[model samples]
Target: MPAASPQPRRPRAGSRRDEAARLAVLHAADDLLVEHGFGALTVEAIARRAGVAKQTIYRWWPSKVEILLDTLIEDSDKRLPVPTERPTAESIRGYLGDFARFLTDDPAGKVLLALIAEAQHDPHTAKSFHTRYLGPRRDQERDMLARAIDAGEVSPRLGLDATIDALVGPIVYCALTGSSIPRDLADTLAEGLLRPRSN
Candidate 1:
């Protein structure tokens, strides 16, 4: 039998080299964090280590904080999707499963945790963290919950923001507490949060 050809990679928006350069920058951030910690990882260092220009990193991200956020965001397909058609239970389970897996399996998660720790004392990074990383995902989850309300799966009385936080808080807890989220936690969150009359 002839040797089978390797499967082609999925098409991304940027040119192949463009994507490679971005990944190079992100991975360079990861490596710098590991070797020297966040205080030592600077944009210039990342650009030099990645063999890309400092301007190149700036073109895609505004700061080292965003570069780290983008690193995790890119690793997770940017963010979780709002469930429009899938059953609420299945949707939450699927989103959370992929999320936990990404955190557990990818170096991106390390950078994410580092950023979270960095954000604690730096107000500027905290703002970027919420705006770039937390805000969109929260909006997506809110949309999903709104759909669930319309479908009569979740209570109209449920506070959208807090509930969204409740569902997502555990994963964040794991990440901040120096642990990778286990996949089963996703199932638990989905089932518990969506359980009949539990809201």
Candidate 2:
């Protein structure tokens, strides 16, 4: 038998270089996502834009949608904090306002809207968005609200679940709907949910 073809020499250095190149590709895809919408994004375009081989992209992400979701998460992760400050009503207001500003600010808002729209048509993206992005946010806010309730600053029966929905729903709706959340909405929402129902 012909001597087993010399086992292909795997270029370890090339593998390391490829890893760096793959990261660059993901970054390029992220930039494209922010500039163009996800619907318009293409793997070929991303590879070209990143100055990497198309095979490099396929070597990592299984699909353009996966790449897009990864990019969105990476980008958002850099901007959003988990709100670990002491849970007071004032803290809640401040945190929520910061979050709202993030969602409404110039380019960030547009990217968020695009992600939401894309999530509507892509179940996997939607699931990931909720589990990774929206779910944690809601959980954070809920914990803050619960703390406020414990501190006697909010209604004991404010219905934590509903309160969370009320607080987050408007902001998300406005962001996705291309509308404003109103200057007073955050305060008003907090007050409405925090005020105790009289017996």
Candidate 3:
């Protein structure tokens, strides 16, 4: 019997080419998000911009919303750093202000608006947003609030869930409304929620 022909080598798992391709796709998606709202985004547009085929996008993301969601998560991950120190009211103010500034900055803010708009119209996108983005953020803030309560910086009288809403609700409101919340206002909002209520 003739010897079997040599098999073609497979690409390495962590090849530089693969990493560059992935980054290109993500960068394309990010740029499109800024140029057009999420509702206007298409997988074809992303693939074309990235210099890849539609199959390449679908192979990684199930839908356009998923692509945008992942892109937003990855981009935000680098820009925002959660505080590691003990959770005090001051720490909460500082962290939230930094996050708010991020949201207001170019590209990131636009992406956030697109995601929120998409979530309003599509249930699957909404679920993905909650699970992939909102859920993790909520959990992280909840832990920080818990630590603040333990530190006596926040009143134990405030319910954990309620406090979470209090900290996040205003931010969401401003983001969706496309309005600015004054710099001093974020600290005040935190104080209003954390301060002890006299019986």
Candidate 4:
């Protein structure tokens, strides 16, 4: 059996140096992942790159994977936020477009893809990836779809997960395959999925 994942260490509050070190570690992890791929990422290498002791990183994160997860979560929160407002097809289209760009163009997206690829081979990483990242994002998407359904803006024929797959699958496929995502792919997806089906 794979060993249990390490528990994260929480740093004390109110230290500016602590916060700075945390940012440095996150940045260093991202840079290393982009430069050398996940296979080459290590706590020692990250410590050298960030100019901080390895123990400092361990004080805040459990492992190199967790450090990368931190970088992904921070960037995803900023770049892929689901708006906390009423549903509109136009607004959803905007979000879809932004999301497509984020996945295809953002460094954070690269990090996410790397983590996902690694997760395919590591059961522990798969669990952590879902629990910390994919699960929450999917939950947010489900909530938005639920709201849209309640508002009668979208049909309830397919359940939330299927609807989400319909909405997000193509963009993700393009990202994974290195295909060029069209500028209007989001508009097409949103309109197609939101269009009323003939009875």
Pick the lDDT winner. 4
CA RMSD of all predictions: 10.8, 4.5, 3.5, 8.4
Cand. 1 Cα-lDDT = 0.75
Give one digit per residue, the lDDT tens place, for model 3 in 100-125.
77777857657777887778888988
Worst lDDT window (10 residues) for model 4?
11-20
Candidate 4: C-alpha RMSD to true structure equals 8.4
What's the lDDT for residue 35 in model 3?
Answer: 84
What lDDT does each candidate get?
0.75, 0.71, 0.77, 0.83
Q: Which residue pairs collide in model 1, if any?
A: none
Which residue pairs does candidate 2 place in steric collision?
none
Regions of model 1 farther than 4 Å from truth: 1-23, 34-36, 54-62, 78-84, 155-157, 180-183, 197-199
lDDT of 2 by residue, 1-199 (tens): 7777778878665345465676777677767876777777889999999898787678677787666666556666667665566566667766667668877873444566676787888898788778867787678767877777766666734478887777767988988877887888888776766674345
Ranking by TM-score: 4, 3, 2, 1
Better of 2 and 4 by lDDT: 4
Please report how far candidate 4 places residue 19 from its true position, in Å: 0.4
Better of 1 and 3 by lDDT: 3
Error of 4 at 49 (Å): 1.7
Q: For residue 6, what is the lDDT in candidate 2?
A: 78
Badly placed stretches (over 4 Å) of model 2 are 1-23, 106-108, 196-199
lDDT of 1 by residue, 1-199 (tens): 9999999988664424487798898889978887788888899999999999887777678888888887767765545444557346567668777666655556766677787788899999999888987787677777877777666665633477876777767987897776757768887877777664454
